[model samples]
Target: MYTPGWQIVFLDDPPRLKPAARLPRRPFQYQRWEKNIFSRGKTHTPVRRTVNICPMHTLSTISSRKSTQPFVHALAWFVYASVIYSANYLANPAIKLGDTVLFLVPYILTFYVSLHLLQVFSRLGTIWTIGGVALFMVASTTAGHAYLFVILPKFGVYVFNPAHPEQFAKDALLGFLLYFSYALLYFFADRNIRRRIAVTDLRHQGLKRELENAKLRELALRTKQENMLQEQAFLRAEINPNFLHNTLNILHAQAQRYSEELATNIGKLSKMMRYSIQTTEEQPGRVTVTRELENLQLLLDIHGLHCKDPKLVLMYIDGKPDGLMVPPLSMITMVENAMKYGDLTDPENPVLISLIMRTNELHFRCRNKVMRRTEIASSTQRGLANLKRRLDISFKDRYTLCNRKDGHFYNVEMIIYN
Candidate 1:
């Protein structure tokens, strides 16, 4: 069966009664409620209430719009070159072709040459930078000298003059001045473009991380659901809930005609069995701490009906459970172990179960007096083994379990860090 993608509510379905909280029909719902259930003498909830961690948006589509600065930079330089050529062309209409070669060609060449020189300077320091600028100046001046004096004159754009040696100085100075202005503009433009690219990369990384976490959670849920379904099928085949209910109802009706105490205990037993069945089938790794403790009290009450000692067990709560949850049946398994092999006849040293909840942690300790060799058989502790396995899958290493045998008692303590 396909489990709901959001969350299972409370892990409670008490046989014939309505569930404590209803499960939503749709998959991947945005808001998920924590394991919040139960009310005994007071109300308190201490868990993370709202789980809004659902992957809602598409992560593959990185939100990196191409920066418009590049296009703007190209246009600005184009206008700069055009304006110089236009003014020169208008002032001397007959020499239109010469003005294009004189102003536009050197200016465009200077812009690109300065950009390359700046990259070399930034990366390799002053030594290599000096060589790079010298190389650029020589190459650009030689090309400019040839275009203006030899090439342009061949096309009837300008006349060559051997006497005007001052013309070479003017062309070189003009080229250096163009380079200086473009370098300043390139510095700011390059910085801004790099900042935009860095921001886009950071955003893409964050989205990628979130998508990965979402996928891992989904896979865990699928694997856990499959395991639960297999166990539920096995359980259903071995024992039918409807048949148990009918048989319990019949026994209860007959016991009520003879004795009220027997009938009352029978009803409680039926309820406990129903709760146990539902928990195995429905737990979403965890069940409400409050609800599990309440059922624990019910189990104790049932045991009380037959046990001779009035002080069979003691449960102490240092802080309110709030809405905290633990792996289903973890607490119950500890109690079951104590009831089966612990000495409960003595009123002073009874089974002691204590729970302490703090700001960011929870502590649980179960201690009981061990029965003598004559009173109890050898124990295999299969229940505690299964509890550890369940906890490994649910809480991983976030919780700690320790069990030790004292001189005459057994002690088990667990700590869950929030």
Candidate 2:
């Protein structure tokens, strides 16, 4: 049998294989074989078996190791106390080293027990812990002093004078102050360390929240962008059907009279369609000013061929179109609106379209005499509104569009800053 990566072999009888090392034998334990059996002239492929250990069992084993830590700390404290007092004994020849060691025994025991008690009480509250620690320091200090002065004299290690009450009082006060000061210092230092750790933890949590918020904002922006692109694509898909309808109508009209002109117009329409589709798919939906102007001229030519008096529809271009780009079909949209609703029959007040470029700015102006006495109820206004929206989305505040009616002439003007 073939295994994924490794193989294991088991023997029924305990026979010493040439290159196999024996593992410690247990009732259910199996030996892990790492080397391939082919190297040892084995004919059959071996199957590997995996023994799964429970996570709870591993966790219990790790927890068992923590029980010895308190004993280790106690041993370390005992060693530290022994070294310090032994040095003191060596310095003073009057006190025997054994007596000094015996002297430290009660003090160490009282100190550790008080420390443990304080640790337990600290979880209750600050006030209670402080009171407990103060009381412990006082009791331990008094007990240690009594042992040193009263009990040590009995052992003939040191002498004490009960006659001088002032000296005894002074020594007791000094011992109390020393023990109290040490305890308070340790307590304050530990509190300071814990406070610093708490502050660091709060700071880390605040940074983590800020990072999460930043990621959420980025995700929202990406989703918004995706939605906008999807809407643009939907709008683009809608345009082709309407555009083909108008182009087909124009082609049908031209085919009745000039078949040669119909072929040329069809090619122009095809180019325009390709450009429109390509520009809509682009991120900014932009094209060069030269390309926009060429398409606009094509639109004018188509409109002029259909109109009775072609001279009434006029277009003028001023300055070079170098280093200039614009949203596709933007300029042509205004011209189309003018041509659709303008009084083109009147040669005196004809539809006028002008594109002027000055430095880094491009200005476009369209003026057309309204043919109808009342407002023209057509899709012209809706198309203009859609164009305005596209301008706002693409150019932001970099362009301006204005439309006003002066007497009989409806004028639309736009300026785009490159």
Candidate 3:
């Protein structure tokens, strides 16, 4: 694609191709050599692989609990009344239906009234609870008096003598006894239930604390492991290279006093070494594109200085690399690979390299003529694989790298997003 500020500056006169000859295709890419294999006589299209990432979350589920006390109370009341009625039947075998109904009505009222009064005053403190007991006694006595004075008359059974007023006091005494007994039973049962709930809450708190402690310990271990790995990597990257860099600087200075050419080459090598040692701090696995191009040119100059073919490799860079940060050795590895395996003896088909740095991204392409005996380019895939790994460490999925090879030439392309 043609873009403003993009140019192709060849180190030699660029070769002209036939009108029908187009560049070879690239393949799916990310952190590896994505091959785009083609059959000798058939055509194929390349497919880029994509990775989909999603976030993860943890959801806490709460189970619902229903109270069974209401059902239990109903069952207990039924059983108590049945046992009492059965006992009365044994003592008074001639009891009538009206008499049974009269006994049950008063019993049910006293039981429920005591239960409800306790429930209402349970949380109101001891003073209110004592008052509620007194109030319950009065209520039960009043209910008993109404049943004795008015309800029994309807049944024509168990008549209370109006002349003997002591019977009223005795009836109230009986009401107090029955009400207190029922209140005590409900009070004890409620206190036991509350104690169980408190114990369960404490257990849950302990388990929660233990889970939090385990998570903290795991985090600490992971942090320590990461620190160790970072230390090892730092040592490997900085130790030997730093020593060589210093030694080369000294040699360049000394060579300047004897041979200008030797000093220039040594200075270039020293700058390349320094850039490699220091580039990562600038942008994390990146150096200024200008620095990379300078080092790359120096490498080509070194190739020409040492080899018979000075124009075997041709590099073309377009657009300003002003603020752009390219990964160190991004293009140099490709040039070296081409030099190692390509048929650079044929001047007509030199190794071609091109780069374009746009507003927010970069594009790079390279091609090399394959040797006559080689069926494919990049036979071992080492240099490209290493380049892929380094870029992935820096850019992750924000970059693309792919390659294509026919019987005679190999082509590679890479795109990096800022």
Candidate 4:
């Protein structure tokens, strides 16, 4: 009637904390830089702080890096382009402002279209931007003075003389060349600026992901620590009940027969109790396999005096690396339970328990021979249940417990990772 360790394993699996516990409550800080600038005996201390407020825009922060700076860059470019075009046109009356506007209109249109295309088609942004510039060049060259000539006269401006065929062909080619060259410079500068922004965004995302993973590992460790404290408190309560039952059983035996062996068993039981409860000398979770075996031996000695002869076999395999550690009293409890319930006096029905530790993993095997198919009653579930909670806090998913039945033998096994 050995209680499977797996039954207790699930009992103490710590419930997950609330969503609030997982969420970060502290305010996120922005990285800042300080600059000291002086002008005419006046000192200006500028603290440049970059905060990612808008989550969506934060991803595109590369593109918006200049957002905090002057917002009139586009307007400034337009003014500069207009002034240059106007100056060239006014230098010679033959080159009218109307003619200049017509020649430069395609270039201006191409720059805006390229920038807008980059903003929309972020993946193919650069390709579309180049394509827009190419389209502008081709369109303006194909239409030539045919389109601009009609539009200029309708607006009451004259720059071209269709009657002089030589002037029309020569001026039109010069205008196209000038506009195409300007378009190349503007598009190249704008694309370079946007490309720098996109690269910055990718770096930010990589950094953010690394930070989140670190936080998750820290939180998982903290939650494990809290669970261990709670489980230790619970296990400490069960010690009182176990001591009371053993003492009562000993007293009943003493009353029945005043024997020297019974007194010796009582003394051993007292020593085991003192060792189990002495917290000052024994650091929490500091019990070695040797100490745990001592506790199990004491339990078996007490059981031999009270119950009938209990089957016990102690084995230590060689080649096991030393300095191995285990949770306090973890293995002893399962072995103690098998001695208490199994019919060990019968040579045919014996309880077999083995402990093995190798390469940071602790394995426990407890088997008891069962005779009949009758239900076994056990009121308290604290022993193995406490073991499970302690294991979870200590090892978490790094371990497993299972119950296997082979013929008439019932086996409970626990595998723990250190």
Estimated TM-score for each candidate: 0.43, 0.45, 0.65, 0.42
Model 3, backbone clash pairs (residues 3+ apart or across chains), number:
1
lDDT of 1 by residue, 174-227 (tens): 767667577747755754554444445445657998999999999999999999
Clashes of 1: 2
Each candidate's lDDT (Cα)? 0.68, 0.69, 0.69, 0.59
TM-score of 3: 0.65
* Tens digits of per-residue lDDT for model 2, 1-418: 4434422211212224343544333212223334355555655545444432223433344355357757975797678667866787688756565676666565556545655665556444567767887787677657766876778778776534667757756765564555445545655564454444434444565598899999999999999999999999898787875578577657756675767677677766666766666676788767889989888888887787767886698888899988787788898888988888888789888888888997878999999998868574457778778888888887889999988888888999989988
| Per-residue accuracy of model 3 over 177-279 as CA lDDT, tens digit each | 7756776686567545544443454457558889999999999999999999999998887788999999999999999999999999998888888877777
RMSD list, candidates in order:
21.7, 17.7, 26.4, 18.3
In model 4, the runs with Cα more than 4 Å from the true position are 1-54, 57-262, 279-281, 306-325, 354-364, 374-402, 414-418
How big is the positional error of residue 195 in model 2, measured in Å on the Cα after superposition?
A: 20
Worst 10 residues of 1 by lDDT: 8-17
Worst 10 residues of 3 by lDDT: 55-64
Model 3 CA RMSD to the hidden true structure, in angstroms: 26.4
- Between candidates 1 and 2, the TM-score winner: 2
Best of the candidates, TM-score: 3
